[model samples]
Target chain A: MTNADTLGALLLENERTRPTKPAIREKDLGIWRTYDWAEYTQNVRDFAMGLAKRGFGAGDKLCVAGNNRPRLYWAELAAISLGGTAVPVYQDAIATELQYVLNNADVKVIVAEDQEQVDKVLSLRDGLTGLEYLVYDDSRGMAELEDDAAVLSFEEVQADGVEYGRANPTAFADAVAKVKSTDIALMAYTSGTTGNPKGVMLSHGNMVRTCRTFLENEDVRESDDLFSYLPLAWVGEAIYSTTVSLMSGCSCNCPEGPETFRRDGRELGATGFVAAPRSLEMVLSEIQVKANDASGIKRWVFNTFRDVAVDIENRKAEGLPISLGAKLKRAIGEILVYGPIRDQYAFRRARWVYVGGAPLGPDSFRFFRAMGINLKQVYGSTEVSGLVTLQSDEMASPDHVGKPCPGIEVRIDDNGEVLIKSEGVFQGSLKMAGSALATLGSWKAPDS
Target chain B: MPAASTAGEVTLSVSGVSKYFGGVRAVDNVSVDIPKGSIFSIIGPNGAGKTSLVNMISGFYTPNTGSIIFQGKDITALRPNERAERGIARTFQNIALFAGMNVLENLMLGRHIHMKSNLLKACLYWGPNQREEVRHRARCEEIIDFLKLNDLRKQSTGALAYGFQKRVELGRALALEPDLLLLDEPMAGMNSEEKEDMARYILDVNEELGTTIILIEHDMGVVMDISTRIAVLDQGTKIAEGTPAEVQADPAVIAAYLGTSH
Candidate 1:
């Protein structure tokens, strides 16, 4: 086993090697603020101190609810550094849903994104007596808010962090020590695609180990760029956008909102992208609709290239090399055909795409690859930390989950439920207090 | 849709054009010629088939019949991107700016039709493609300054107000540097002041740039003031076509307006 002790130590390692590299690019109001490796480590430190100053030290649990934004992530890393666990409530979680997570985790402090999010917390605050202070990041609508009941600005907290960090040097490290891989990092509520949302406690090790295992099989570069619009509270996004990004020192681009997705996705030209079937379906619909408006000559060219793409796909599907004639033709056609089409879709830099959240149709899967866009299906959940089985571009597997990730050992039980045992395997069961540390338990057969 | 097959001086022309959505015929048989520099206006009530007729011309929708002629070529079979390449640009019924992009980046999309380089050149960031990109960026900036969007140049379109967003959409259409500029209700939902501002901008776009202008507008005051020629459609057919005063007095136009609640 490659003994990497802790998540904080991993961050430190990346900091030393890639201090100047951008770790996060928060596209705010059209302005890109780069949080490089060095700055990122320090910001997480300050965030830990700030939380401590706000009365959340090691062993204290907190709740954060927000869309995919930089401050939301910073708050998470900060919470982690301070040895405090956090319950990530969905951004779209209504008052009752928020009530369940907050009440269950017995949250002491809460950091919300905006007034709308804070209102959700406030709606349930009467029931959540454990909640002490409400930290709101976006103050856009809060300026006119008449009720301050227990509200505090995120800026004010960060300012306190500056003062707190100055006074207590060992406070951050001390907080981090109590946070082992075995320590539960998040109480992610299940998406309930099948049933009601269940709080799945994932540990630091569960997250990092799964990420590292995937890394061993797939190639991820430090220079890779990503557009992280998926909900931070979703386990899928946390694994790809947060854990994987932090591990590789990759830059994560946060779009302004869902409305600006296509424009933002085009602008970022992200090297690694992941989405559910719906998101991919929406984009593909636009591409086809727009292509329907092409001129005769342009349409002809597009058809020829699409044919070439189909050939490429078929060859790979049959495990055959592209014929010499086809190769020569494609090289020539690239000038008149494929290159412009790829640029149009802004998939020029895309290394590979993962679409899970639901089953992806074979036609949908092959169409992207045929056109030289590497997209694959991944199967896993919040409990498994993103992907346990993912297909690479050249392999093009159908009807199979393909191979398991390096360290994640998977076995199908009699009930047909896949059980994964690995280095970061969390023993945190749903039956226990959701925020409790992982208990290192074996997989049990599901009850009828 | 008629083929854009006129032998000479045919910038954009549509003949025998009609559009049907299920049982409702949005546009009836219509024929029109927009000269190289003429300012054409398509006006009618909400269901007057003005926008639908324009959509046929801009290659957004293929007509169930007739042909659309542009610059002595047949583009009846052309798609929107092809129309874009053949020097046709258009705005949307609702603003369609890339909200994640700044005003500058939105304008850069206009030049996308003009970019000659491929993805390889872009990914490697070298060769003649790189030179063209830099050159186009300078041109885009010039247009931004001209539009007085310099202050909001760096701001994301999402952060902008509706009026400013429409202006950015206009700027994006302008970036295509097309011979034909199609403005789809560019002043829709704007207040009087915003309308005036947009009217002035549209006039500058047509006059200063010498670009052919085709627009859909509900505001008759704005239409009468700017349109060189006007075509009115009712129930998918051109009911009236003439100078502002002539079309304004046409019985068919008045009856169509009276028949529908405008």
Candidate 2:
């Protein structure tokens, strides 16, 4: 149980314990679609069999193109279940941007949504030596297209599996066992806003260890719902929604499209939140601006209480223990200030707020904490499958990004750059390892 | 050779093809005739259900009530890929290329229907099925040469410039070798130079392959230049349909715009 490296094994164990518990909640057509742990396990197994029926084997690379959704997660699970690597790309990326990733990873298979994605893959069908198949999720506008050989719908693949599994029922489990921790689980290309993107290779071990370490420090229950908004290609969200959701017995929720989180997060009441600092900043800023427009007594009380709490947190951050007199004053401020504040944001029982992707300001950190939110910073990389080290709830700091995570050896380099090495540090890209990665400080160049 | 359906003699027909979201018609009671090899254009302003109309025609959406007949077959209930299989293909309003995949892979997705073996055999890459795979690869290379996308053959679809992305999208649509090609705002968000390139590619597709084109375009200049016949849609309803000159002179189309202008 402690040394589980394979994702397929980890999921099987959890399914046994909480078979009926919800595992995935994907928003489809303005509704949240729930898949329980048992159902999800079957889905992964069936999808893996389908992949094998579609000619996918151990060590295959599958490019998944879609927003944060359950099917996208299923694609990852299914791909992994068959000992294949899943490469998730941002849905908004243009055809040109995907060209490098497709070429470099030599993505043999693509699982995509809608005509938009299908068309893009079609555009680049010229020189791709490895790419041979496209499995689309949506049949919209695509019913006229036949799945003869190189392309298929996700459902068609599953149907093929019905007969395929009958022919070789144990093939899926065998492929799962054949998957070594050293084999790549996912390849995330760094957003190449600047130059060609570089693919960051993350192994099964790197991903599994990250999820385990984060869960060991914080308790996330089966009841907790995590809203997935960020691109799955991004490490922060993938860890929280994909890896962490698998490690901790929790359900990961994906909104319908963009801004879906904002429109529906209140309804979801996500008990655990993992988002970038930008999202946190945006929400807080909006709340602050709206509060400013509030009339009379409400505005006045909010201001006065917030002012007192901010001052107290600032003093504490500066290493000052509140005097007995100050502690009493702080308790009064907590009742007046923090309680109502937390209530407004629906953080009543919110267990964790993880902010990463960029440095979170000290002021924002203190403000969130003052409101009883255990907002912590997690420092990570896509290559590390999300976190290398994360701030604990007790010792969460804005200025410093907490201690080294379990199983990792961390050191500050000569150039004052943070260096992390562990069983979790991915073996790097399968194509052009070492050279493809350019160490730009702690951040590596993304595969273009 | 697959028999070529003759030009501009009504190869495609839309009989009241419509769509609704929570019972509000994005496209309502819209029908048109597209002659084989004719360049037909649908013109409208933003939120006038222009995109929705194209979506229905491209098989992205099913008409709640109506039939879309393409190449003498009822395709109203057909899915996007099914439509693609019936020689009906489309480009996007926003270029939807698989950005992480390479240029060649994008083109290969277009030939997805052309492959001979089952997915299982293709994945294994063996024997007779492998030869079929090689044959398709060679065919895709030809499409790449025709589009002049060979230079960026191995480039990531995500990293390509905007114009090239749009070009690659068009190339993908052309790969289907459609009897009727639907182009949704193909020149939107492009620089003048890029638009010129797209216009040329559209002309080539229509002229060389004798493919019927149903295009939704906001750019009047490009629409007027390329379309043999034009249809005007305003507020999800078809206002007029005729030759380019006839549509340009129609009073109802002008009144629809002028009435809304107030």
User: Where does model 2 exceed 4 Å of error?
Assistant: A1-3, A144-149, A191-195, A321-346, A433-448, B1-262
DockQ category of candidate 1: incorrect
lDDT of 1 at B222: 97
- Candidate 1 error regions (>4 Å): A1-3, A145-149, A193-195, A430-448, B1-262
User: What TM-score does each model's chain B reach against the true chain B?
Assistant: 0.92, 0.91
Q: Write the per-residue lDDT of candidate 2 for residues A58-145, one digit (tens) a residue.
A: 7788889987767667878888878888888988888877887888888988888876788888888786678988888876546446
Can you give the DockQ of every candidate in the order shown? 0.02, 0.02
Among these predictions, the greatest lDDT belongs to 2
TM-score, cand. 2: 0.64
Which CAPRI category fits model 2? incorrect
lDDT of 1 by residue, A1-448 (tens): 2345456666667677889999888765454678888888887777777778867876567777887777778788888767667677778878987787777677888889876798887778789868888889876446534367578887777888889989987877667766687777766777444555666777787777878877776778889998888887788777788777878778888876655556667778889888787877776677677667988887777777777877877777878888887877777767776666566666779888888867777766666776667787787766666666777765655456567667656777777865666665554545556433334433322321
Candidate 1 interface RMSD, angstroms, 1 decimal: 15.7
